[model samples]
Target: MLRYQWEDAVRFWNSKKGEDSERVGISSRQKQKFTHTAGSRSFASVAEAEEVKSGQKVGRLQLFEITHRKKDGSPMTSEAGEIMEKLKDKKAEYEATASTDSSVNLENIDNRIITEVLGPERYSRVRFQGSGVTLTQYFGSGSQQYMPSGSQAKAEVQRLRDQMAQMQANTVE
Candidate 1:
């Protein structure tokens, strides 16, 4: 896996090495540090809290700190800094979506109920809207997908209940 990654990176680097090509100098240390802490939700949350405490309403996402160095341990070029900034912006956008969109609060719903009734596959498709506490089930394929409601949703829920009952009855033996 590492070999494949190394080869792919080398291939990418080589492709960018033309007369007019400006290289982005990213050091291994920076890469290691970024990889180590990039996905840490707790770290991001703490940083965000600290920013809020400092009276900043909205703060830049500190996804990764780019060290001003190149692949050869030289100073970073302007092109590299620009690239890193772009990367940071992209990461912030993704984190923003992940933190906001459909972060579930199964406070009133139990995991056992979900597993026994709806099954694991349907769990991801279920969105619990907080306003009216509506359970919107996205059904069918990508562009053709639609939310199930009214009689369709009721019938599906009933079917799941029946399945759960049958499973419980069998378990009693």
Candidate 2:
């Protein structure tokens, strides 16, 4: 999906006319960074975070810093800093466990970090929104190739259920 989004962006930029005729170029590395951040909801590694921080003209260290800082460049309170530090430590612990334990799924670590950052309520909303979008996109495109309409889809599902019931009845005999 990210690849498709990247391709669509490239296509749109390349299609510009007039003064914008000089096609805008985006690097593959930038796309990779975008995909990594979007997919994992975090940077691929601390090195990648530093690389991003170096390229930023403003908001340096914003990735690791909580947003409750004052305009005077001081933390709102020591508690905010402490909380962020604890979260960072937890993230590091998860990464270490993932590295040492072959059975650890990296995606689970990402989900855990996102859930921690967003909290349970917001995290659930985000998950629901994602699922809604996925289902909408799939049915919008997939229906055109499979069942043409909602009635047909319902009919097909009913037909499958009936077939399963018939098979069960035959097996009982």
Candidate 3:
């Protein structure tokens, strides 16, 4: 796959079965091609052009990059403690701004998987805040949750059908 057209041409020229001229090697053909490349260029100029640079050094400088990320497959380090601290602050702020009727529990959710996997420190940080960067922007506290594939579709469709039925009932009679 990596072989080039010039290589095949050179091979064909070298291995002519019926022809009987004194054989020409690929290097000689390449030399001739290089010599005849441009008008007004001679063999001496060609020899000078092929000269290797003197005292060349292939020196190198080492470089590396560090990465920070979260691991979730098996048991991993928890950010729960840091999360709880921030959540408490956010809850207080929300409570102050919200009207009396807002039903935000401001309580820790009891999830065995989260607690077991993350430990108290990290498990405490994860909560179902509204969708946005607000929950993750401060202190880099970002958490993503996933469930069965069809569950979301089923739930959304059920909710929409219920809403449509309610709207139709309101319009009737």
User: Across residues 122-147, which tens digit of lDDT does each residue of candidate 2 receive?
Assistant: 32233322223342342344424322
Clashing pairs in 1: 25-70
- TM-score for each model: 0.20, 0.31, 0.17
Q: Give one digit per residue, the lDDT tens place, for model 3 in 13-89.
A: 57754133434454465454111122354323333343333333211000000001123322112343333444445
Best by lDDT: 2
Span of 10 residues, lowest total lDDT, candidate 1: 126-135
Q: Give the TM-score of candidate 3.
A: 0.17
- The whole-model lDDT of each prediction reads 0.42, 0.47, 0.35
List ranges where model 1 is wrong by over 4 Å. Answer: 1-75, 103-173
Per-candidate clashes, comma-separated: 1, 0, 4
Q: Could you give the candidate ranking by TM-score, starting with the highest?
A: 2, 1, 3
lDDT preference between candidates 1 and 3, better one = 1
RMSD of 3: 26.7
Using lDDT as the yardstick, the better of models 1 and 2 is: 2
Using TM-score as the yardstick, the better of models 2 and 3 is 2
How do the candidates rank by lDDT, highest first? 2, 1, 3
Clashing pairs in 2: none
Better of 1 and 3 by TM-score: 1
